[model samples]
Target: MTDQVATTEAPEDWEPSEVQRERNEWRRRRTLRSAVIAAGSTLLLLGIIGGLVVSSPGWERVQATYFDWDKAVSSFPAVLEGLWLNIRVMALCAVLIVALSLTIAVMRTIRGPVAFPLRLVGTAYVDIFRGLPLLLVIFLLGFGGPALSLQGLPTSALFWGCSALVLSYSAYVAEVFRAGIESVHPSQRLAGRSLGLTYGQTLRHVVLPQAWRRVIPPLMNDLVSLQKDSGLIAVLGVVDAIRAAQIQTAIDFNYTPYVVAGFLFCCLTIPMARLTDRYARKKGYHGAGGHL
Candidate 1:
């Protein structure tokens, strides 16, 4: 028996069976065919739309007014310089909004009769700001703030305009943060408390870290909206990108500079939108298009 032993083993270069290989090849062909069809259909639709637009009677006038290459080139430098101011304003306001909103959220979420006053203030703040249109708030602060002539305070429209932005956005973001905090299981808080942690300690150590993770996607979306609205500071004569575009348009009545400014904003927005979608997908959230 010891002299007679035979073993059967797979070769080191084993391959799929014929049926499996055939199935794989068929799947690959089907996928390629589907992609070709989809792409062809898209190209056909785009071509048709482009042809229709080009054939329109007003196309030439529209192009000259909005798509003038020379105007865009000339205005690019000023518009870009103005954009940096918008970026700086957005950055500073974003930081303030985060801190203020988080404080409001914590105030609203805290329990007990002792916290009733804080909760009331937070609730009132959210209701008032969220109900008011943001543009209106900016107008009030930008135009009316300096009229008060308060001592020791800056009267610059830029300062008040940014303050208005921070106040308005903080209201909306506080609710988002509060929702995340409340979404956590009550057991988490109980567990923290059971470990002899104070309520604030538990929230700071356990609740906030988890809540922050859950709310990041929504927060990013808010930031994108903030980026776009930062251009609204132009209403206060801040000379931001939109304002710079306005100046160029005012010069020769050509709307090309406005188009250029819009294009630049879209450039910033598209990447942020894609990043948000990627992050949401990574966290297992699917959109209306499902996995695709």
Candidate 2:
């Protein structure tokens, strides 16, 4: 009876039935049609908005101020030079922020009375920094830290500004890490402990790997934001892309340099955003928001 049933079953290379083939063709056509319609509607909407803008009275002046080709070409070199600094600062701050935030997250998650003070300090740090505006923190560190003239500390606004970025971003990212850590099932920890693993070993080996994987999408989003906000170091007298643009704008009152800077930022940010979306999709997340 088993042999008979096996012989009756369709083989791996068997063709689909007529109905199944028809259904598959219908699905393919439907997908193609939907894609075409979506593209057409998008283009139509953009064309309408663009026509309105171009027909406006001040269109010429707006174009000259914000989109002057010559000005953009001329300012490109300086802004590109300045952008290198933003990249370096952002890279350094990102590394520091991840290290510090992970430590704080671990501290917050530790149990027992012996760890209470560490947890309390971690909580206070997150609360205070999260509540304070990032720009304000940058201002305080950039100006106020230098004013103190502490012997061992550097007075460069760039130093303090980057420090402020690390501090402020770590608070937000620590919460992200903590959320990921908490999402791990208690059974996993118990299993690790039952295998003769210590608490620290359980967390480091069994827990952190999973938590880090789950939190990557949100972490990337935060880093994308960090990349853009790196431009704010310009406020501290750092000659970053935005500052270079500002200097060019001052020379001739043309805003094209500012537009160039903005375009460069978008170029960096959009790819990161798309990669986050791709990763989220790969992890079975299907929504506008992706979180652990």
Best by lDDT: 2
How well is each residue in 16-74 modelled by candidate 2, as lDDT tens digits? 88999999999999999999999999999999999999999999999999999999999
Residue pair clashes in candidate 1: none
TM-score of each: 0.92, 0.92
Which sections of candidate 1 miss by over 4 Å? Answer: 1-14, 288-292
Residue range 181-240, candidate 1, lDDT tens digits: 999999999999999999989999989999999998899999999999999989999999
TM-score of 2: 0.92
